[model samples]
Target: MKNQNFVRNLVGTAILAALVLALQLLLGSLKLGPFNITLTLVPIILGAVLYGPLSAAFLGGLFGFLVCISVISGNDAGGFMLFSQKPVITLALCMIKSTAAGYLSGLVARSLSKKNATLSLFLAAGIAPVVNTGIFILGLLLFFQDTLVLWANGQDKVIDFLLFSILGINFTTEFLVNLVLVPVLARILRNLRFVKQELAV
Candidate 1:
């Protein structure tokens, strides 16, 4: 039984990881408005809820790697710009933000599941984008402030430009998407639970 569970987990993790890779590589440039919307976060959140922190982290790391590929390939103009300025810092930021987002979301979900399962799932979904974007903004301020200032185009308030002008739309879209997905994710969880129970029997 333990071995079967392990195999199931391994397969599930692989499937999620593949989804992450495909979304990052193929649909990474998917955009609704001005900024690019990252669809990869959804699967990472799903992995967090379905598997655990480690699996989520691995998927997130894979997402980060694909982003790095985009940067290196010059497909991500902003990322490439940052990479040109600071290669190591840019790559590290890419990896850290996504991985931390996944790990933290999974950890939060696991910890809070003991209380209210639904609330924990919603919060976990919500926190993924928050942590991902928060770390990105911090990394910009810390390492790429100059680039941000340049992008601000002589604006007096860099922070305002960064948050409101740059990240506002993108963040809102990601957050809303995650929240709206709660129902679908909840249904998936229930179905999975049913399958597991049946298998156990």
Candidate 2:
């Protein structure tokens, strides 16, 4: 039984990795209103709730790797030219923020699942963007504070730069997209769970 579960998880993780990569490559950024919505976070959140933290971490790592690819390929949003100047810090910030987001999403879902499974899933889904963006902002401040100042040249303070210039439309759209889509996707998956049980027979 343990081995079977392990195999199931291994297969599931592989599928998810493929799915995330496909989405990242195919539909990574979709422009909606004034925002560019990133679809990669969806798979990370789904893996967290369905599998667990380690699986989520793996997905997050994949997501971050894709981000690096975007940087190198000249498809990144804010530009990663700085990455060429400071490779270690840039890579670490990217990977750490994404990995933490995934890990925390799983942790939050598992902790709340006992009390209320649906709520747990909903909350877990909702927090994905929050965790992703929050960590990103914190990472910028910690690792790129000096460089960020140049970006925020006209702003009175870093907070002003972050909130008004950095996070305004894009992050808001990303958050809303996750809030609405995650729950719906999770619910659909939950409804389809019976099919897996049937397959077990």
Candidate 3:
């Protein structure tokens, strides 16, 4: 029974990973002024809520890999480069952001599940964009702060830009997209028999 359960969980994780990849590809095809909205993290959140942090991390890493490939190959119109001129750093940021988002989602879900499963799932889905945007902004500040400051022509302006860009524009856009999409997707997935049997443990 233990082995069977493990196999089932493994299969479920694989499906979730594939779904993440598919969503990334689908979102890549759309354009939104240098920012394409994606529900890729939804699967990661669901996997984390269902399986555990390790599985979620693995799926997140897989999603990051897809993003890296798309960026490097110019498959998504090279928006992944983000004026960095450095593919390695860009790739590293993607991996760290996705992994952290997934791990946090799983941890939050696990902690809150006993009290309120529905609320926990909701938080799990909602936290990814916040985490993702926050980290990306931090990374930008750390790596490109000098360039941004120069561009802004003042330190104060640079700070303001970072604050607004990170917390206002980027976070708001990602939050709105996730807010609209994740609940519906979570509901649909929750109703699936396989999801219930495997994830509701």
Indicate which candidate wins on lDDT.
1
**Residues 134-187, model 1: lDDT tens digits:** 998899888987888887776587867777755777787888888787548557
Ordered from best to worst TM-score, the candidate numbers read 1, 2, 3
Give the Cα-based TM-score of candidate 3 against the true structure: 0.81
State the TM-score for model 1: 0.89
lDDT of 2 by residue, 1-201 (tens): 989777876777787899889998988787643224688888788787777788888998899888878766667645365576677877777787778888888888778776777777777777777888887788777777776776677445777777865577667777777667776676666576611321111
Q: Which pairs in model 2 have colliding backbones?
A: none
Q: Which candidate, 1 or 2, would have the higher lDDT against the true structure?
A: 1
Cα deviation of 28 in candidate 1 (Å)?
3.3
RMSD in angstroms between candidate 1 and the native structure over all alpha carbons: 3.3
| Distance from true location, Cα of 190 in model 2, Å | 2.5
